[model samples]
Target: MAYTLYYWPLPFRGIFIELLLAEAGQPFEKKSPSSIYPDHRFDRPLPGMAPPYLVEKGGLQIAQMPAIATHLAERHGLMPSGAEARAAATKAILDANDVLEEISQNGGVQMWEEESWGEFRAERLATWMRIFEETYQHHGGPFMLGEEITLADIAALGLWAPMIHALPPLEEDLKRHAPQVSALLGRLAQRPGLEAFLTAQRARDGQGYCGGEIEASLREVLGLKAEG
Candidate 1:
């Protein structure tokens, strides 16, 4: 059965699924809600009107990032085989997803008002990335979770790619504190399959979905005023 991804044309949460597919070297059909008018803005695509949904075996549709990620990981043998490792991978992936949700909601930028909520969000992001760096340092061998690349590593990269673009400070943080992560991210992007995906995406849409280009998008989305 061919895998089918139902998502918006934009990266959003859908990139995680794309990463999994690319890593597994699986061929799947990409469906954008926008391409279909009845899809209604082509935005959300869940039973409860959520998105990042997937269909397998032709008709089984699943929603939510974690759900879809786990489903794909298990199906494609991307997850660890050991019970403890599997649990850890799942937990780490879900934690990364939680951070992605929080950061993405803030319009993927540092342009939000510096109020209590914004401060809290920024702090949370800092804490999450720090923890992630440490965790990767501990569990990741050549890759997060082991010498082999697992769903955990893919999830981490998927979440970090956009967040780092949105928060430029993250690049500096990665260099200073998480050089491992920075290196891993660079390696992931340069992987033959992943690089093809990145290049194809850039060719198809000039808008940067990777970390480097998201900064400008953030400025645009937040409508930042020019500095004197």
Candidate 2:
């Protein structure tokens, strides 16, 4: 199946869809937002504000990360069979999306202040970590939904791995508060296709998380050198 993904140059939300395609061994083309927005934005197959838009081989288009993820997961056999399981997987995907929004401070709407960032790291962030950790523990898993890996596992990986990769200090927080979640990330990283994709992604992007002044503020708070 031929697929085209439209997103920003940075990984951010698009990485989830990319990882899913990679894990499924599906080949896809990526188009940048620059190529789509303000020109074909409203007239595109699926009209949407902002990107992470997905267009299929047959000219079907989908917008929003979770919706695109669900479509791909269903098509690629990444979603589970049972209704409850599917619902759970969907919940996981949404949860991952929520985490992304939280970390990005609602799509980088406001810069992260040190005090606020500290509070988030200590409280809100820790709560999210525990939520994942507890969910993993409850399922008794090497994966999020237990024995078999699903899009949920991939979601977890997409959410945390890039954050930890871009901000190394947060790795310790994840390891401390959510060891199983950390372990799950380790297992997902070991997948040959996913690992290769991640390597190439790192080469291409290089620790650039949600770009702009908000990201600059994040780096400052973390004492990280601004991306060069």
Candidate 3:
């Protein structure tokens, strides 16, 4: 089956699916809509007005990060087997998405800069981290679900990783207070497949976050080398 991912190639919302595919030990084609549309031309069909969409074999197209993630996990057996466990994992992914939406509405560029933006950003980040911390602690550390990694873990980690570019302080915060999450990231960093993908991405995108210092840190933490 040919798996084609259509996104802006920013690793923003799309990286979640990318990480899932990486951890699944599968190779898929990444199609960047922004790059194709930059010259005011089209190379493929647009998935509605949204990005980070996926088109599978038989012309099956799906959009939304959380929806795509859940679909992939269930289809590929990356999700939990037990019905209850599966429900919990799905709920956790949606919860994470809710937090992300809050951030996008308040902290993202959706609204003009205001004093509340700073407060909202901090509060929401802390809330999300705390949620993960509790889940990690309850699940017995290392991963969100359990010792065996699942889609929930990948979903949380993938969604959170790219956000580090927007909020550089989060790395320090996670390191200081949420050592478990940091440790989980360390484990994921050791995956050679993920390492290769991240290395190529950093090389092509350059160091630093947002196309600057956080990007370097991301590469370093992910065990990726800088570009020439």
Candidate 4:
């Protein structure tokens, strides 16, 4: 199947969907930034406000990171069978979206100041991370949903890694406060295809977070040369 992904050159939000594709061992073509539809075109509302849309070979178009990842998971076996498990996994994807918004308050237009960073670290950040961690634990897994990798694991790990990169101070505490989450990252990093995707993306200089050129968190994890 030919999968075409349209996003800014950066990995930010689009990475999660890409992670699902890579983990499924699927090959896809990433559209270049210059070729992506003008952002202003999507600036109206709803589906019009984002990049990272996907076009499948069958002519189905999907937009939004969570939507795209979940859809792909269904077809590629990244999401497991059974209604409860599927619903739970999709809920986890939404949780990751909430986590993304919490960290990226302005949608990556700016970086965090000291006071704002403190507020995030103190309350919302830990709360969001725990939501994911508890879900992982409840599912009883080496992967989310237990025994098999699913959209939840891919989405959560995708959120965790780059966000951790953009905020270096959290690294030490993240491991301290949520060891399983850290352990999960370690495990996911070992997956050959994902590791390669991350490595290749990070190697690109100036690959911004949402194209803002400010996300500094991925270097340690992705070996990113992009400016912080």
On residues 64-99, what C-alpha lDDT tens digit does candidate 4 reach at each position? 778888888999988888998999889988887877
Question: How many pairs collide in each candidate, listed in order?
Answer: 1, 0, 5, 3
RMSD after Cα superposition, model 4: 4.1
Among all windows of 10 consecutive residues in model 4, the one with the lowest summed lDDT is: 213-222
Q: Candidate 2, 42: how far from true, in Å?
A: 1.8
RMSD of each: 4.9, 1.3, 5.8, 4.1
Greater TM-score among 1 and 4 belongs to 4
TM-score each candidate: 0.78, 0.96, 0.76, 0.83
C-alpha RMSD in Å of predicted model 2 compared with the true structure: 1.3
Error of 2 at 126 (Å): 0.9
Whole-model alpha-carbon lDDT for candidate 2: 0.88
What's the C-alpha lDDT at position 142 in model 4? 91
Question: What are the lDDT scores of the predictions, listed in order?
Answer: 0.69, 0.88, 0.66, 0.73
Tell me the tens digit of each residue's lDDT in model 2 across 61-97.
8678999999889989899888977888898889989
Ranking, TM-score, top scorer first: 2, 4, 1, 3
Error of 4 at 66 (Å): 1.3
Task: Summarize candidate 1's per-residue lDDT along 12-124 as a digit string, tens digits.
Answer: 57788888898889877778644433454344335434556677765566677788898889988888999988998898778877875565444445433446345644577
Off by over 4 Å in 1: 34-46, 106-111, 115-122, 165-169, 208-217, 220-228
- Pitting candidate 3 against candidate 4, the one with the higher lDDT is 4
lDDT of 1: 0.69
How would the candidate models be sorted by lDDT, starting from the highest? 2, 4, 1, 3
Backbone collision tally, model 4 = 3
